[model samples]
Structures are given as structure tokens and as C-alpha cells.
Target: MSSRSTYHHGDLRQAVLSAALDVIATEGPSALSLRDLARRAGVSHAAPAHHFKDRAGLLTAVATEGFDLLAAALAQAKDLKDAGVRYVRFATEHPAHFQVMFQPDLHRPDDPELLAAKERAGAGLRAGIAGVPADGRGPDARLAGVAAWSLAHGFATLLLSHNLAGPIGEQDPEEVFRTLAGLLFTSDTAQPPQE
Candidate 1:
């Protein structure tokens, strides 16, 4: 049987998405092409376009999937620190997704599904920091959430870029993130931050 006949109806979309992820993981998002993904998935060149419309549509789907995955990961965390570590873990684990999810220019920023997924991920991130008490002179809950996100994102980017290999020296990325979180966010759970 031909490879094109292997994919059932819905399977082709996922196969294409998976192929896109593989390409992004190996060569970065710039390497992704609908034609290339279709070839990788063993489907006709028009198959991917049918599902994704074009490259931006394909990337938008990838970003949406990434956010959904991130939201799920964040939802599993026990606390802010755990969430931060999980965020880093998600980035390292889904480097291609991570790379595309943040680059609005690469995907259709106005896409409804993408916007919703982004909100879900943002809500998950905010919920992670919701219980933490703000230092009297520190930021409000909103700012605290932003700070937490920045810290995790920066660390993840460094790790993905291999910039942490020297300073971290093979130390577990998650553990390093946990330690970093501890240093930054006090264990004491005083009153939660003001809105």
C-alpha cells in the first residue's frame, strides 16, 4: 500500500503537525514548509494545505497545541515554584513548540483558536502564582505573575540555547529552576498579593 493511503482522515493533520514539529525541532521554525511537511507525512503536497491553509496556519496550529500542552503542565503543578520548574521542563521538552508559540510574527496572531489557547496558558501561569504573598514593597499579583513567567522563560531560553551548560555544568535543569525559584520566591506564604 502507498504511504499516502496509510493516513486516515484526521490522522493526516496530526501527521503533518508532528512532521512540522520534527522539522522545527531539528532546523528551527524557519525550516518548516507545508510542502516539506506533506512530503514527510507521505501525503500529497495539497494535503497539508487542506488542513492548515498555509505555513502560518500550520504554525498557528503548532502554537495552539503548545499552549494547550503548557496549560496542562502548569495545571499539574503544586505551587508557584513547581509551576516555574514545570514551565522550564515544558520548554526543554517541547523546544519546537516553545520556539513557535512565542513568535507571533510566525503564526496568525489573530487566529481565534490560537488566542484562546494563549489565554488558557496565561491563566494557568497566573494561577500558579496566585497563592504567593507579595513582598510589601514588591509587585502586585499581576506583576508577580509576569516576573515568575519571565524568570522561567529566560531560564528555559538559556537552557535551550546551551547557554546554561557552562554555569550549570550538567546540573538538572528542573532542579536548577527549583533552586532558583526558592531563592527568588520566599517559602513563607503570607497574605496573598493584592490585586
Candidate 2:
């Protein structure tokens, strides 16, 4: 059977999503269009429109799926450091999804499915943060969670953008991320800088 016929058999929505991801990976999100996705999926131009309604709808679906995937990855992490490494791996492996997941302006932020998936991802990250001990145990824990997330997210973004390629050289990104995560989350006996 032809590709279009295959889409008719089943999984058209997933096919369209996969096509959109390929397009985004190759040409970036700005280049994404429902019509183009339909063409890539070998479906009638109206087929994708029926499922997604518009570009924003398609992006919302992508964002939701992205967050779900991120939550699963984060959930597998044994601790904050492992979570950091997993976050980087997820971003690198799913660059298109990772890009859409962060740029809220591109999708319907109020979509129920999107919000739920976002919450799951947040909870997973928070769980990782909870593994770390803090003195205050209330406000300090919250602050530590935010800092841990920021560090991981920033590191992943920079690594994917090639900002770390020069300084990192051939060293493993996982090891590097683990080291950074440890320094930030774990206690160290280093002396403080003073004037």
C-alpha cells in the first residue's frame, strides 16, 4: 500500500507528529506548516487539518508529548545528578520536542493535556530535587529545586547549542554534567572567596 493508504489504515496522528518532528529537526519550528506535514506524511492536505485544526494545535500536541517524554526520563533518574544527565540526553535526542516544550509562545499553554504533561515533568524534576537535603527544609528546598533545574536546563541548552563543544573537547557530556550536578547539589569543603 502507498504511504497515504498506510496512514488511513491507522496512526495518522502519530505519523503527522513524526513528520512534523522531522521537519522541525531539519528546518526548525518556524519552517513547520500543517500542509507541509501532511505532504511529508503522505496524507491529503485536509487530513492533518482535521486532526490538528491549525499549527498551534499541532505544536500543542508536540509540546505535550515532549513533556511526557521528559517526565519519563526524569523519573528514571536515581538522583539529582542522574536527572541532570538524563535531561541533557533527552534534549539531545529529541531536539525538536525539546525546542517546542520550552517555547510556550508557540503552543496553547492553557490546553489541558499540555498543562497535565507539564505538571508531570515538573513533579519529576521536583522529586529529583527532593533527594537533596537542605537546612531550612522549606524555603531552602524550594530554592534548591529551582537552582538545580536551572543548572540542568542551562547546561543542556548550551551543550545542544555547541557552546560547550570547545571547552568540553572530547570529554563525555554525561561525566561533565554529573560533575557539575554534584558540585551544585552536594556539599563540598571548598573555601569561599573573600576580598
Candidate 3:
């Protein structure tokens, strides 16, 4: 279904974003347009322009929504054995947003909403890292974030790129993710408290 919008509608922004997502899902990033989104939303073409100056603004909104959702999902799995697995789940479940988020050239990260969303996503990831045992001020700390982000990002990227579908072998994605997370979560040395 297309989106619906009304200035007074509580969910107008969400409706617009959702409709944009559907459009992106079927048409891919290149086809996104504020006018098209407005059409889908059954709102005036100029209406979206107000919320999103152009395509970048629209994409920024999508990315912000995605980051916010990702942060929430990762936070929910806080007590789970591995937050990285939650990260993978977040990426898989929100492929469209995840797709828009990383492709900076496709969306303007400087957009206020986009920046806030990016910070939230980064904070969520750092929180996940913080839950894990690690310490240091330089290379080691950087490694923790990179390792966790890379592992999750790599898994999500590979899955989306369809490069790991068969090589992953006889296991469901979640099972595989959990198993991988366990291995990755294991530090080379004993767990160290965050500094």
C-alpha cells in the first residue's frame, strides 16, 4: 500500500518513510525521488519537499529511522550472550535502512536527522562493545569496535550480497550467527574491564 500523509496526522512522517522504504525495496536506491514518495504517500508533491528537501533528505530520514531502530534492537538484546548477533539481526531485518545507511554518497550524512541517527547507531554499537570485555585507549579499544563492527557488518554485507548463502552450510542464519558470535566474542586473552 502507498503512504498517506496529513500535516496534523501523528504518523505522517512514519507513513512517508514507510512508503519510501517500499519504493526502495522494489526499485533500488537509484530510483528514489521525493516526488515519487509524495505520490506514493498520496500527498502533494511539495509536501515531501518540506520534510525532505530532495532525494538526499528523504534518504537521510530513512537512514535515521534505520539507525534508531537498530539502536533499539541491539539495546533489547543487551543481556543476550552476544550483542553482535543482535547487530546482525538488526541488519538483516532492516536491509533497506541498512542499505541506505552505509551508502553515504547516496544520502547526505550531514543532514541533522541523519547525523543524529548515525550517532545513535554508533552509540548503540559502542554500548554493545562496552557490554563485552575490552580495555585500552588506542589500538586495543579501536580494535574492539572495529572487530565487532566488522564482523557484524561483514556478515550482513555478505548475506545481502548473497555471497554466504551456501558456504554457510547446514544451519539457519541465527544459529550460524550465534555460533560465529561466540567464536568472535572470545578474546585472544582473558576478558579485561573497559577503561
Candidate 4:
């Protein structure tokens, strides 16, 4: 006597995940709940537990899913110079995942699925950075990655926070992302650290 969607029981896991993301998208991570997700997905209240042990388990799955999708997006960029834009695009497009992926306290970071997805995402970014001709090595590469990540993360965070929506207009987020990327590449001039 289950009330799960009859369209395709096979996609139930993905359906729940999708619904979870939708929930996160509107209410932020702290607001996510398995019961609500089940209701959103048109499934019996018990449905999500089959794929996720509990609410924490579901959030963990969402973070893992987010990392995997981020890996896919980074992989699609195909160039280091495109990394920032790709990063921003992923963040804006996958706000729910982006929101939870960085919150280490919300989900178990050592979860096998999360670890594996993290590595895949790291590899994708590494590959993307490799395309940068002047990209350096060691700490330089690490710093470069941090810088690019910061730029994209900062931009996407702003977008998610609704701070940038005012000025961005119709200029595709990519365009602003690209412009910022250009800013990153344009000059190395710096004054000094503030005391």
C-alpha cells in the first residue's frame, strides 16, 4: 500500500535527490527535511529512507551528488581559463549542491561516496588548471587553484545571496565570470598587505 509515484519506481532515488535539491534550493541546507522531501517527490514518507538512512544520510547524498555534478561541469569546461566561468556557472545552476558541498559540518566528509566525488572534482579542476599556459607548480599551482576557486566561489556565493542580481542584468553570469577571470589574468600589480 505505498503511494510512490507510479511513473517509474526505478528513478525513485534520483527523484528524491532531485526533490531534496529543490527543497535546499528554496530554503537552504538548514531547512531540508526527509519528510518534506518525500512529500515534494510525491512518495510515501518511507520512500527516501530506502536510499538514505535518515536526514543526515540524505544531505550526505545530496553533497555527494553535488560534487559529482561539479566534476562533470568542470570536466566539460575543457580549459583552465574556462575554469572560473565553469565554476560560477555550476554554483549558480546547482545552488542547492553548492550550498551543502562546502558545509563540512552538515554531512560526513569521510563518507566513501563523498570522498570519491571530492577526488573526482579535484581531478577535474586539476585538469582544467593544467590548460593554463603560465600556470606554475607546487604552492603556486595550489595558490592559483585557491584564487580561481575564490573568484568563482565568491561570485557564485554573491549570486546565491542575491547581492549580484541587481547589477548583473542580462549579461549572462558567464560574461561576468569571464570578465572577472580577465581581471585575474590582467595584472599582477599589488601594493602591500595591510597592517
Local distance difference test scores for all models: 0.90, 0.87, 0.75, 0.80
| TM-scores of the models, in the order given | 0.91, 0.90, 0.81, 0.83
In candidate 4, what are the lDDT values of residues 43-138, reduced to their tens digit? 777778888988788888989989998998888885765877788888888889999999989898889989999999998888765654452333
User: After superposition, which runs of candidate 2 have C-alpha atoms over 4 Å from their true positions?
Assistant: 1-9, 137-139, 187-195
Best by TM-score: 1
What does candidate 3's lDDT look like per residue over 46-79, in tens digits? 7777777788888888888888888788767663
Candidate 2's residue-wise lDDT over 95-146, tens digit each?
9999899998999999999999999999998888777765553447678788
RMSD of 3: 5.0
**Regions of model 3 farther than 4 Å from truth:** 1-11, 79-81, 134-139, 187-195
Candidate 1 clash pair list: none
Local accuracy of candidate 1 as per-residue lDDT tens digits, 27-57: 9999988888887887777888888999999
Each prediction's total of clashing residue pairs, residues at least 3 apart in sequence or on different chains, is 0, 0, 0, 0
| Candidates sorted on TM-score, descending | 1, 2, 4, 3
**Regions of model 1 farther than 4 Å from truth:** 1-10, 189-195
lDDT of model 4 at position 46: 78
How does candidate 2 score on lDDT?
A: 0.87
Clash number for candidate 2: 0
Q: Which pairs of residues collide in candidate 2? A: none
